[model samples]
Structures are given as C-alpha cells and as structure tokens.
Target chain A: GAGVSQTPSNKVTEKGKYVELRCDPISGHTALYWYRQSLGQGPEFLIYFQGTGAADDSGLPNDRFFAVRPEGSVSTLKIQRTERGDSAVYLCASSLIGTSGQETQYFGPGTRLLVL
Target chain B: AQSVTQLDSQVPVFEEAPVELRCNYSSSVSVYLFWYVQYPNQGLQLLLKYLSGSTLVKSINGFEAEFNKSQTSFHLRKPSVHISDTAEYFCAVKSRVGGKLQFGAGTQVVVTP
Candidate 1:
C-alpha cells in the first residue's frame, strides 16, 4: 500500500512570498498531522486533523500558518508571507482511526522548503 | 504541557558495538512515549513505543527501550549496532489523550565500519 506522500519534493521561494505544501495521507487513515524539521533538530508539531475538523492546531507557530483538509483525505498547508525562518523540511504523517496518543503515525518523504 | 529531552546530541559507535540513546520527558500527567528514526533525506519511521504493560519494549531491528516512570526516562539501546543503523533518532511524548506531540532535539547516531 502507498504510504503518506507529499508533492513538490522541494520548494524554493523568496521571503514575503506565499507557498502551499500538499499531503496525501494513506488510504482509510482518518488522522493527519503536519510537522516541521529544521537542521539538526527533531520534527516540531504544526497541526493535526481528525476527519474534516482540526483536532489540534496549537503547534502552529503563528497566524501566517494555516492548514485544511476539506475532503478528509488530502491536506494542504499554506504559509503566507514566508520568511527565512521558515526554511526547513515540512513533514506529513497519517494514522489509522484511533486516538492520537495511542496510534502509530506513518510519515511522508517530506517537502524541503527554502525561503530566501 | 509536555516536553521531551534527548541528552545526547550525537552518538558515534563502531560496527558491532553497543549503543544507548538517552531520553527524558516532563509532563504533568501520564503520557505515551515514542522513538522515531530518520535516515538522511528521508522521513521518520517508528522504532518503538511504550504505551503500557511491560516497561521494556523491543523493536524488530534488535533495538529495545526501557520506560522508567520513576525516572521519567525512556532510553533506547541496541546490543550491537550495524552500519545501517546510522540515522537520526527522535524522542517524542504526548498526553495520554492529546493529539499533539512534543519532540526532543533529536540524537544523531553514526555507525562506523
């Protein structure tokens, strides 16, 4: 079966530009998550969605970051006015129909974004 | 609030040598623990997890972790590491019922031939 996958493996944009990262979760998985990983650092949580609703989004750093999963299968993370600080690898993960703390999340290859 | 700490930023070991990655966490309530590995230019893969039952948990790749509640630690260990074991390891924790995870800075494991 296909695992979680992301589009545009690499994205390079200038500061103040807008960018969107896409994620396709595994089939039948109801939970989706987004995380960001900087150099020499572990992944930091960004947002989480259960079904069509966002179950938790406190991890989003600021108002410039937003994500949505309208159809409940694919998700998109939109960043407005990108900054150099946003340069990092964006990861997406998905899990079966279970509570967050107890479920195992499978990750995607990630999209490396560079904001100059 | 919950947070995880990986004490060792990097661990270098020769092939066939033993290795240990220390992890500690702080949380106001009981939580779930997880270990994830990431090769260069790749995504994270689940190594093991400690939800309940026994304090010691093992993965299929001859790696094991012992969850010590009293110490607030979940250290991962491998008796003998292979060259293929070189990767970045992350420690994560979340509240028993929460959806968001708090991750440590991560540890880089380098296996030498």
Candidate 2:
C-alpha cells in the first residue's frame, strides 16, 4: 500500500550539468506522469507513459527533457544541460488505467532541483 | 489544451469559520475536475473530484466541491475549518479521455484561531 516516491528530495547542481530524477510509482499502476512546478505558478505537464512507452511527450520543454519507463513500473526523468531556468520541483504521479481515463492519480513528494 | 485558474492565492480564516476557495477552468469540451490539498513538505493528496453524474462531490475530511459547467468552475468549501485544514489547495482539470492534467496556481488556506 505504498504511494508514489521520488528520489533525492533536494538536488543542487551547476548549470550545464545533467541530472536524472527517478520515480517509483505505486504497485500495479500502469500509467505514469511527470510535471514541473515553478515558484508562484501551477504544475505544468511534462510527459506521460502508458505501459512502458511514451504516450505524450508534447509537454516536454525541449529535447533536453526526456523520460523513460522501460518496464512500465519505475520511471526516470533525464535532463541534459540543465539551465538555471530548469530550476523547479519535479513531480511524479501514477494512476490506474481506465476506459474513461478519469482515474485519480497519486502524487509523490516532488524533487526540488536548484541550478546554481 | 486545458487550463485551470485559481483566483485566490491565499485565504486566511478563523477556526470554525466557513471558507471557500475559488477555481475556474477553461476547456473546449467536458472534462474531469479535481481538488487536491498539499501540506507543507508533502505531496498533493486528492480532496474531491467531479467526473460525471453528480455535480457536487465531497471529501472525507469535511471538504466539498461543486462543479459548474456554465461557469466552468469548481469551488471548494467547508462549513467550518479547523487548524488542521491549513494547506495549499489546487484545482486540476483533464480531458475525460486523456490522463494529463492542468493545475491551477494553488490557494494557501491558513486557518487561524
């Protein structure tokens, strides 16, 4: 009965460095999503995974933002050449797949990345 | 693309006072509405949702939200707030067929005595 969990609650890195944020979805969840939350703003969608393959990556800001869920369970968000602008909290969520796609998603305590 | 707007950034209320948080969303078609609450240093937790059928939904923790199609709003309310209710509340919307969500700038509710 564990919920979604993210690694490295806080990460500080220099600009132009690469970072990888990991997410472990709830057991038996096949749908995963990634979002970014900036100060004084709402969370913005980044990508979605359905059964191991990337279903929607349009929300990803650029090629530098990539995510993978190789086995349809755990996921990792990879950021290349991280910029100061990329400083924000990365959130991960998971939900059960449904015919209507209205299932409730459980969120993880985001990972706050600071690019100095 | 779906979008959500939370009008109030913060709401301060005395303990045992009624409180309301306003939320409005924009979408071309019918969508799913949800309310999530986040405590300090915690992830968001589901408060309530309005998917279909009844436009009114309530959470176990004495919180409720009414979905209004005409206004495209889903405002959260509670008859009497407690100190434990202090947290950031978010409004989210997504297409009925898509799982991606669009969240609003959260509303911070501070319950004071």
Candidate 3:
C-alpha cells in the first residue's frame, strides 16, 4: 500500500561534488524511472529500469549521470561532478508493469538538489 | 521523438466557474496522452489518460480530457472547480509502448473565491 518514496527531501552541495538520490518503488512494481525538473520547466526523462537491468537510459544527460537498480526493487541515481546546471528536483516513478505505455506512473515527492 | 506544449502557463478562475487547460502534442507516431496533477508539497498524481478506444477520458474527480487526433491536442476541462482544485497540471505523451514520456510545461490553476 505504500507509494514510491525518495530519501533526503532536500540536498545542498557544492559544485564538483557528488550526490546520490535513492528511490524505493511500490511493492511488486517491476519498472522504475527517474526524471529531472528544472525551474519553470517540465520534468525531463533521465533513466528507466525494468527489473534489475536498465531498459532505457538514453535520457541520461551524460556519463557523469548514472543510475543503478539492484534486486529490481530500489534504485539510486548518482551524479558525479555536480554542476549548478544539475540543480533541480529529482523525481522517481514506478508502475506495475512497463510493457504497456498505458500504465499510470506513480511518482514520489522528489528530492530537491541545490548546487552552490 | 515527441513533444508537448501547454498553451497557458497559468489560469485563474473563481470558485464554481468553468476552467479549461489546453495541451498540444507533436509526434511522428501514435502516442498515448495523459494528464497529471501536482499539489503543493505533494507528488504527481494521475488525473486522466487517453490510450485507446474512447477519445475522451474522465477522472474520478470532476475533470475530463478529450483527445483530438486531427488537432493533436488533448485539452482538459472542468465545468466547475473548487478551491481545492488549485494545483499544477501537466500534459504528457509517450510515443512508444513502455517508452519514456515527453512532458509539457505545466499549467498552474489558481482557484479564488
């Protein structure tokens, strides 16, 4: 009955530092996704995982941005050399099955990352 | 590739008044349409979606969205709104089955008494 949850509701870090954002999907969910939302902009896709393997990761901005989902239940988004441009709200979502695009994605409260 | 555009950035309406939020999408392939709502300090919630069959879809609440293929638009409307309806609404599209979503800039609805 629990929904997707993210850790560290807010994070503040300096440029060139590293940060990790965690996401715990709903129980029994087989698919997970990450997105980023900048001020005055809509959420942009980042990465997706189907089970323990990443099904789609084309949305990842660069090699500095990586994500891992071990055991197919929890996911972590890691950012290396954080930049002010990476400052945004990191969102996580999950669905029962990702085979159909019709599945509704349940979102988390998101983690607000600020780079100073 | 797919793209979505929300016509208005903000809409202010009086309580119990009609309200409409316009959304348009562009894609080379057929896509699934969806509307998501986000209340302050809350996560994004699904309002409604248009996958197939019916061109129109309604949410549990008093919200409805009509999908138009010709116009490539999925506009959400509500005949009457409550102050509780104040929130941000987003229009999104998925070009492929189980693929990533393309979201439009959200529309902030401010309901006033």
Itemize residue pairs with steric clashes in candidate 3. Answer: none
- On the 0 to 100 scale, the lDDT of residue A76 in model 3 is 96
At residue B68, candidate 1 shows an lDDT of 98
DockQ of 3: 0.77
TM per prediction: 0.98, 0.98, 0.98
Off by over 4 Å in 2: none
Model 1 steric clash pairs: none
Cα lDDT of model 1 by residue, A1-116, tens digit: 99999988999999999999999999999999999999888889999999999999988999999999999999999999999999999999999867446988899999999999
lDDT of 1 at A35: 95
In order, the first chain's TM-score in every candidate is: 0.97, 0.98, 0.97
Count clashing residue pairs per candidate: 0, 0, 0
* Number of clashing residue pairs, candidate 2: 0
Model 3: lDDT of residue B38:
95
Pairs that collide, model 2:
none
TM-score winner between candidates 1 and 2: 2
Output the lDDT of residue A102, model 2: 80
